[model samples]
Target chain A: MTPNERLSINQATIKYAPLREALRVTADAGITSIGLWRDSVEAASLPEAARLLADSGLRFSSLCRGGFFTVPEGRARRAAMDDNRRAIEETAQLAAAGAAGSAAVLVMVAGGIPQGSKDLAGARAMVQDALGELAADAQAAGVTLALEPLHPMYASDRAVISTLKQALDLASPFSSSVVGVVVDTFHVWWDPELFEQVARAGAEGRIASYQVCDWKTPLAADVLLSRHYPGDGVIDFAAITHAVKAAGYAGDIEVELFNQDIWDTPSADAIARTIEGFEANVALHLGSLSGDARP
Target chain B: MTPNERLSINQATIKYAPLREALRVTADAGITSIGLWRDSVEAASLPEAARLLADSGLRFSSLCRGGFFTVPEGRARRAAMDDNRRAIEETAQLAAAGAAGSAAVLVMVAGGIPQGSKDLAGARAMVQDALGELAADAQAAGVTLALEPLHPMYASDRAVISTLKQALDLASPFSSSVVGVVVDTFHVWWDPELFEQVARAGAEGRIASYQVCDWKTPLAADVLLSRHYPGDGVIDFAAITHAVKAAGYAGDIEVELFNQDIWDTPSADAIARTIEGFEANVALHLGSLSGDARP
Candidate 1:
């Protein structure tokens, strides 16, 4: 029943599960780690959710998200910033409640262009400004703000940050531990500069979280749900995994799928499939475990 | 009925139009130029298509396509190269038979990663090899091999070349006139490096064509047909059009809509809408026509 030591199941892969059920199913599947979504954590009340995670003994890999800071200056923008501050505190607390290897990393999706706006550069600038405002809070809370670059297809309404190089550039001004980047395979597999950016991110000490999922096209009617289990798509997992490993990203690899079909499967079945996919497609290229996993 | 002198209707915008109808509809709409698709041209017989275009007194903007060179070296690969050679010859003849401002440019869409293979880098290298093999023939035939960078969404199944920088790098190995690039707004409007790369393409003297279309969400079930008319979506045409103009490109600006709804419209009605969209969204930013249009 032992899964790959570095495997972490992002809760979104099992969308319908309540926080306690998600933790129990992941633990019972022999998976030692989980990435929590803010909705489930909030729904259960953070204190109770934290207790459930502690009892499950699953290491906390990362928080599902915290950055939608593309709003223009106003009450809405202020509210978004305040929410992010709360997320940082939640990330810190969740990591404290999990097993020894838990990472206090909050994945950030710099939101799409502010509604009714076509100023992409301006939206991106807002992200940088938001980071400047939030970095000190994140640092104080000991939470890493991990910026994720979504695929370009979602650039207008979901995320304007669309390349690893762009994400790295945005993170350049802050300390690596305070502000870093997420290398999600689903979002960045198409980037021409991926390997080079992976190396550059490593050199700059900005690789905060590494998430994996496969990309098969004829994307879902909702392009957001187009992710698949690894080894199920055309993505070259071996080449990308080798690059990430070479770049010294020695941490839990989270599988965060958004596909409706995968979400419909039972939570334990989904986790089992994720383990099989990771072991067959990604774990083989990861070399040895590097002593980073907690029992 | 006088359209912007620089405006051109790419034949695929009206996918069902035969060569004669496409030419007649475009000229009747007062559009001075048209980009022809190879299939329609072949349908009319290249010679007859050229005669129809010349009779319509429309300038030849460019040929619809020429490259799909991601196959492994074998009979299929050899067949693809031969087909590209024929495309070059057709481009030369069509440009020769058109009005004075005709451009002998053959748009090249580098094929996707070969089926069942995940070697993206290898597929890209094959594009380079294909271009090298055909550059001499293109140069001799006076055809500009316009390497087009489709959106990253199409990287796995349509075109491996998904960025202007990548296309430019591939074209750098040959003369700018022999190997050039297409600046299709629908494909590249999301690129973070777009403006910088547009300036680079201009500086390199490698911009062979400039195509415009818009992007909106709730993309079609078939993503290939997701393109919209210029003003129909969120792209900042003023900014991008200005960038292209500032890059010193004075060629015909082609409006190539691939949306199913647009294709379903009567051809003349579609061209009419394209003119309106371009005039409102792109033309104003284009500044004064640079004496490049023919009467």
Candidate 2:
């Protein structure tokens, strides 16, 4: 009954580490799970990356991304869907397919508004159409497309889906086994409907990943990499974790921070902080704040 | 019939202009309304500022701000409440003291999460409690506390109220005559619940002010000043303006750009661009998009 049983270190938190080296350090620290970007896998060759993850004795929590459907229909859009199909193939290789939490999810970051267009509605329509088209391929491969709704600030440039409710609605058309969403704290902690949405996501069995991180103030120059470790900022982890857990979630808690400061640290030290932050700020408070014992 | 009838140049958009100079140029530029920040009023002396505004024949749209209740109870909180009473008095002097978008609004930016505290709920509760204490004073002065929900990025340090729905809900206990909400495009364009919320605010007779500005991408270093003139960014002004107009709003559409670049421009040239951008991107589209004809 290790407290770190559900812990997973997303490699993005320490991009400075080589893939094999990151895995070695994660294992050395007695970590049991991981989430990886497709770029890392591609850099090492998919076969080698998969072999490395399999040898590390760590659960493959999810793959980084698969959607950028904002491109206008034509060659670019077709290529995106083809790329996602390949991503599904990779998820299948991870061999954690299931209808429940056992499945390894392929995270979908619905791309930003297309170039030279202010048509947010048109961009969103493309995401829905892309999801509907890709859902069958994902189901056929027995892997899930983990729809991720980024913060609204990223709406015009990163993802049109900016709320858990929007993500859930987009996934509603697809089966739970093929489509779900990432409940990433940095993107959704400020949502007024968070508790209710988390409960709904749990009931629908669409909570594919629950990523934790803090939102640092005076956001870094690169807004994308401004996330801090949990407890380092203002998010109330206890309340959110309680809501997610109460909604029947039992899965790995992944730390996927994107801060440049965190990236500069050696992987081992960063891993240590991630573990400490998770256990102290997140894991310790999950069941307690809800006034219910851990399931 | 001038197309810019409802246009009002908020002094923040022309940061380079002195108070009297801004008023004079606004008058010369054929503008009929202006929104004032208390800092500027304090700088010129309230009596002198009021005399200038009254003499210039400009409609005083609203006052800048009055809420910072994130400071916990005791001395600091009492000080915030006292400041708000002073603001209400000034709003009364603005002489736009009636609802239906006629009254001068005492803009309220609910304070950010308190120092060293991750409790967003607690901060929001403080705002509500503080509002309850000040609503009577605002009502007595015939000024509305126009609650302004800032963008979520500012949730930590500017305002906890980040949506019109949340602002309206927070003001629900008070009469709409005393408590209303602002419709600011820059702060709320990413909101999925925007149209519904705008309609609801109008239905409740609580649409106190409508502020227009564009959210530029690659946000400037100072996030507070990243706003652009209308049509300079990706917000669908025609769509939002149509929705607000359809909701029975007929009042000055205040241009409140906060960009350093805009502020650096010569006040007259910047003010000219503000008017042009509003007409092209907002005003011109409003009556046409709504299809009922401008009332």
Candidate 3:
């Protein structure tokens, strides 16, 4: 049962699985690529995780995250920058260890407004400042820091960057290779400027990662975990996938669901469902994968 | 105690109150203006509601709503348009019945994506079409159809228009008086382009209403009811209120809360809290209201 050649299972979609199990199940399911989260990588230790990933023979699509840079200038801020630098190193090493076509991309979630603060613009500026501080390191390590604009619902407590245009504007100061943006459908499908921003991100050559998940209403009590399998929700994947393809994003497209029910499913079954959903809702619009060969 | 002379209590802040009781509580709390919901007005019958509002001697700031225009062309769509027309007539009558400075403004929530349909763009176009069908009637009644862009979380199930810029763009082809946009803080506070759009709305003379409510995360189980009283959450009222004021929206500033807790509070207590929240979080930034006298 071969999954679409471009399909990459984002590990968070099967959250309860550790790094070894996640890689084993993904590869066993005939998936060629996987995106890893920091927790699982740290649990296995970076070197061992890289070895496990190498044995699994799956391309490393991206590291789950790297940024929480909205902290004010202080001990906490210094700590966050240091942590991000470590994440950049992890991304570089894992991408090196994976099969051919691995991508050295580190997804960044600009942390919400600092606690006790209502200055959203200031928090956003801190994200800009963090990017400036880290661009040189990311470029040196050949890791693209992919700034992810989370949905506005999480603006106050999860991420201050809430639109693709805002993410692109923040990514403007650095080189596209060093600073790019993540176009996660769940976070951005509602954006009126989505298609326009997708085109702009494409023109700028900064579409570092394209992640797909579905958004259904009656959002879970924890809105963070409300994403569903593609085709299980109302997202028009045909349009968005075609737009991303038109944007020239040839990297492995990642399916990243955070729903609790999906987590309870056996990793193999989850992978099976993901593959089916991807083929039905997203893969059709991805065009042919022959030209998608990446080193 | 005099509430800010420009403060208006949106009836939804005290959802249980009947139209007559809502007016009584608001006026009894020394609030000089009110924004009425259609359900309560319909409950009292429009003519009787108008009479009660007049007897209360409070200015009518605006009507609570008028649009759910995202339905596909069918009997449902036709019914929605007709309902909106009645809403327009209700606004005209209510404004006339209130004290001087009443605004015949009808707030419009562009309905969610149609059931089982994934065509957001198509649904939005339907909103544009509905406006075209209703604009002349609104103009004929001297009523402003105020387009309210709900937050992106509600984009799929509640409102497809999720940003002030989108609302303004949709309102562009119509006269500002006949078609304007709502600057509701809860719906738009997370927008990165908010200040810019507010200024543009001002320049276009399209800001028909300015409503304020705070947004706290860990949103209610039903996201629609998560609104908080001002100053109780992370919203920066000073920045937003100043932006709205700078944008030339001198109309009544309404406090519209939907939280079950706020709704359960006694009507008089809720109005008192609304007044307190408004004074502390918003009114200070509004400058003196002496020059804001509008008829």
Candidate 4:
């Protein structure tokens, strides 16, 4: 793996920090790539935020979102699609400015149920329709839409795509080159088919990006943001990573943690710790696989 | 579905109540069938508990559980298997006396990480091995082993099988009639393949039992019990039920809730409200599907 296949930090890691500070901290920690969530980008003025990434010499791996299309007909549906269109435009703008790299993808979190409807299948259909429209926009802009399958627990209020296989199936009809998957370990580690899906995504060149974080048990719902760093939880990251590698996916391995505990720590400490955790996790993983290869 | 195929109450809904009180409340609520947890059965001696079930004339849908095979090899493994064997014997004893029906399966919640083991695959293998042993015993007793696939969030410590597909796959190698699956809505509602798996389970004659409850967003881990009653949350229960029906499943639809809030309320009220919620949910769901059907 080359430096290009190294780590990217999701801005949500230090969501409390100003975007500029987060970028500087990421760069200082020697991670040259970053994933910027849409909410944070929206919080900042686009052009100004674009300048920060440019000046910092950081690669935007993905523009963090564009999908919440599970809305009832009429105003809600139109409004969601309209908002998504704006998000696509923003992603394109970031890519043009080198903030979001030319190769950077637009990450999507498929929305949950439409209010007043328990028809999850209908909502899923709406997501597919919304994705089709967004994919068209993304294609025109040379941006790949990376569908992130959230944890199943969030199927109701968050992303409806809760498994990598499900996400790939949803994106299958679309051109895999333009619409792909974001394999986030935190969200998918519990999936029994994680390795198979990761391999499948990689085989089709549909692995838009790879993200890592640990899954803690006895998790608090309110600690929605609290994630253990990679190697600190029960997930078999090494096996999944090996599967991804076996599939020939050579892309940036991003460390995107949404943890209140990690966020409350100093930015310097958090970024430094993340980098170390990444190194340790990968090293331990490789060592275990290679029968005594050690860092 | 006949009265024989009507709803059963899983006593874990009133797990907080004393066994006698729980039985009384369930019988008074006109729930002719009820399931009891292992701890609750032990709390009230097995013979006494059998007598109570006999007196109330409520059939046991399933024995609440008997599986922790993931524990590392040693005394713990021996103990878990032994305990499960005892549970099977108890289930048989109850069946022989006509306290529970001959078809009452033992629902298995496969245990999570054993102490000092990070090998999820290994733990899963251990679970399979344990089930292999228990399956023979269950067959001898004429009781089926219902593999209950829990929500992925509980994958680490509660159940490794987090999807219906995974559960069905695990039980497939065994005789479909001997080893089966319990389709609990709370555990499987978030599953994208819920409908497909239900059809498969029913087609294979592996639908040992069907359970229903709702998944509350912003789930609390401690009072981890489900708070969302049927129709109170986002799951499309009607579609799932309809699919099961179409697939030739004619088993009791068990109402199993574990809400702390509901438990604190009057047990009688909880049972009544649960039944009402079930009816309302069925009506609302059927009405929605029919489109022209009025309230």
Candidate 5:
């Protein structure tokens, strides 16, 4: 595979760079695929961001996020759904010029339990309600809502969907063509059932995005920013990446690091190391497809 | 249910205080049961600590913990297993004078992946091997090994077993009377299959310990010390406590907070809030327990 065929740098890994600069640096790195974040798309006018990606000759792999459906109603919940709908529209515009990229996959990071509420079940139900409200619209816009189950550490404060099984369960009501799940190494490498779940996800044809990032030891005080590039931590990426590949996943793998220390580095340097780490710790596993990872 | 009948303070909750002082504070606060830690018992001299609990009339709920079987090697592995046997001996001595506490329940925290390794499956296998080595001895010494599945966030550096299902699976090969699993609210509260697992554990007669500790939002810098008292966090304690009750788990609920902020506070005040939180968030579910809850 060409570098562009397999590697995509998620904008969050070089968050300090402006949308145009991020796209430019990623493209300049000889990587021809990129993932955009909703914030970055909005920061530049959506039309201009679309024009930039169109002109840069990069396949827009996926969008960073569009789900925070964990707030209670009145305005906050409505506002969040409305924002997500708008994100879907933005994703549609960017993918209009799709090449090998079929369409922009909009990742959904389900928000945590609502504030002043401990009803985890209620919060999860709300996520489903929001998805039901938006699923048809997503199909209309040609944007797939990819549910991303974050680490359980983020369960209370970020996403209640803390496993691939839960994400698929939530997505089961919708057609796989419109809704799917993300298989990100950072969120799921610790799972004892990782191989089975990956295979299950593959069989269901519901893997919408494949994201890679390493979990750094001595985690940052703000654990959100503790993710390093692939090889920097203890995750056995060759095993996880191989699991995804064995599961019939042939899509672009996005490198989405969230380290504050890495963010402080120049975007060029960061993107360079991301590519290096991906090649060394992650991409090496892409060569073979039939091997089953051990439990 | 009487306050003393269901509630017990784990020594690690007030780890700042001496073992004798923690027990004194517990007894002074009208609590008649407590869980001891190996460090606390060692600090006070095991015989003296046992004498204190026996004299104070506090029913020992369970021992704090005794499992770090992830270390690799002949001497290192043997050393860890030996230490665990000694812990069983200590537990047996403390429980000889029992009132509603037939045998000492030892909470086993299977250690994380060993240094220079990323083999999670191997670490878990090693844990099973160690349990096999100790199960007979634990049974002989009148000790029940309770495997605690910590939150997934602790999977890399603290424990490899990160789910109730995995813990139950590991304990399956052994007799329930010799091995069991801990249902810690702080750890397993985020799981999607929590209720199902709780019921499975109960049906299998493996709910050895029901631990109560809240997962504090905006977790402390040291993730280890981020546990709050019951009502102080977002976990729906009523839901979890009720599930454990419905699952036929009749066991002492140990409050095992590890917050640094609370640790800095006077032990008496911490113990007071624990009881208050227990009554408010956790014990309300205890009112209709079908006469189930052991000391």
Candidate 6:
């Protein structure tokens, strides 16, 4: 199958796998693209990781992330900025190695409320400022920065931008291709305005990427679940994809899972199952619909 | 303090307490209202339960719940309907026993996905149909049917009405006084349209209840933290309360905590600490604000 659409693997699902092993496993799964994270890519080093993906003809869909700008001054914020700069440079290197795109999207997980600040709005401003700086670097490198809106559980500690509208608003000053929102079903399926927001993202050409997962119950009331899997829970994937497609997005559809159960499985097996699940969950939706009916 | 506002203690917070202890402890807390489960009230018998609330001068702000209307067959649906009727009768008994104006708000926790059914839309329709029947009964008894939209996580197996807008839309055919949304901050805080919805609820006089609690994080992937104290987490209570007040909701601000931590504590201690936390959080926010801005 010379698949016209692209399938990107978020490395977190097989987080336990070595970077090279993960690339090999993902490649074997027939997923065309892979999203890389700082820690994992750094562990493998950019040149070595690039060489491996090059040898395998794998695509770097996007960089895992670059943002945590809500620290209260001093070292952490500066360190985060420096780290983000490095992420851009790394994305540039990955792009140089034949990833087949003018710019890879630099996904930004906006930071949360700063310590001692009940002012969430203020922290949001800090994210915007950080993004402004990163956008300049990203623009220079011909890379896009995708701001991901996490679930509300992470609003205070992980991301202040917790909705598509919120992310779009923050990225308004930038060109759609320079900065945009990642429509992750795991984070946004519960949103009442999800359809409208997805439409908005599409209209503005702000849909940076799309991720799919289901939300299950008996959720631990303490930590946010990164443990979502497609079809294991209840997310209206068919409905969301239809909306996203209606909005004119022609980008890669990425599957990013954060489940302990999936990770416990062997990387090869996990990768294989995930690819199967993705094809079943996403492809079936696409396949069932006529091309004209997608939107 | 001749408290004019309605203050209901949801039984789940004191789930460990014998129904009797919950009543007496709630009374001692100086809160006038209590929300009881049908099972608890039925177990205690209507007369004895009435006497318990009467002796303590406690009121029934609402029946713990009655609408799990998404069952597939005649048997389960009929059983749920009958159970709701019994809840209404028990609520009338409480009203007759000097708990005047303390009529029940039938809190509906919509049932989850039917085993072997992917029809969320169908389940939601079933809930609406059930509400049509229950609303008539509740109206006749002078009780309000409060459609408490569970968080989206519960949309499948709990209440499919996962948003204030959807709940309000369902209740539109009924009088606003008879059908309303339970404004639970824990469930609705992350909603980008919260303020707008609250205004709509208040405009229609459909704010049947206002439940408060923090949205604690680091939640385990599968379980929602039902038990949370107000002002203890990321939710912006000060903002929500301000919107509720501005919407003209002159009702009791009920403290509904589902945390196991609170339940394991002595009922008296839990009640005492909750009251203190409620007051302190309000005061902290109040003092932090400028001018005569009221939240």
Give one digit per residue, the lDDT tens place, for model 4 in A1-295: 1222367888888878888888888887767788787777777789887888788887777787788778877987898888877877887777666543435588888888766677777788887888877777778877788899998878888877889998999999888867999988888887888777877887888998888888876685574675788788887677777776666666677788887788889988888788777776753453333332110
**Which ten contiguous residues of candidate 4 chain A have the minimum total lDDT?**
A286-295
Worst 10 residues of 5 chain B by lDDT: B286-295
Off by over 4 Å in 2: A1-3, A96-102, A286-295, B1-3, B96-102, B288-295
- Model 1, runs deviating above 4 Å: A288-295, B288-295
Q: What is candidate 1's CAPRI-style docking category based on DockQ? A: medium
lDDT of 2 by residue, A1-295 (tens): 2447788888899898888998898888888888888888889888888788778777788888889889999999999989988998888776452123434689899998888787887898999999889888888888889999999889999999999999999899888888998999999988878888988999999999999999868998778888998889988888878877887778888999898888889899999998888888888866443464211
lDDT agreement of model 4 with the native: 0.77
How are the candidates ranked when ordered by lDDT, highest leading?
Answer: 3, 1, 5, 2, 4, 6
The regions of model 4 sitting more than 4 angstroms off are A1-5, A99-102, A283-295, B1-5, B99-102, B221-223, B282-295
Task: Give iRMSD, candidate 4.
Answer: 4.4
> Model 2 clash pairs?
B96-B103
Q: Score candidate 5 by DockQ.
A: 0.59
TM-score of model number 2: 0.95
Runs of candidate 5 exceeding 4 Å displacement: A1-4, B1-4, B98-103, B290-295
Relative to the real complex, the DockQ score for model 4 comes to 0.52
Give the least accurate 10-residue stretch of model 2 chain B, judged by summed lDDT: B95-104
Clashes of 6: 25
Q: Candidate 3 has which clashing residue pairs, if any?
A: none
lDDT of 6 by residue, A132-158 (tens): 877888888877888999976677678
Interface DockQ of each model: 0.54, 0.49, 0.59, 0.52, 0.59, 0.35
Considering TM-score, which of the candidate structures 1 and 2 is the better prediction for this target?
Answer: 1
Query: Model 5: how many Å of interface RMSD?
Result: 3.4
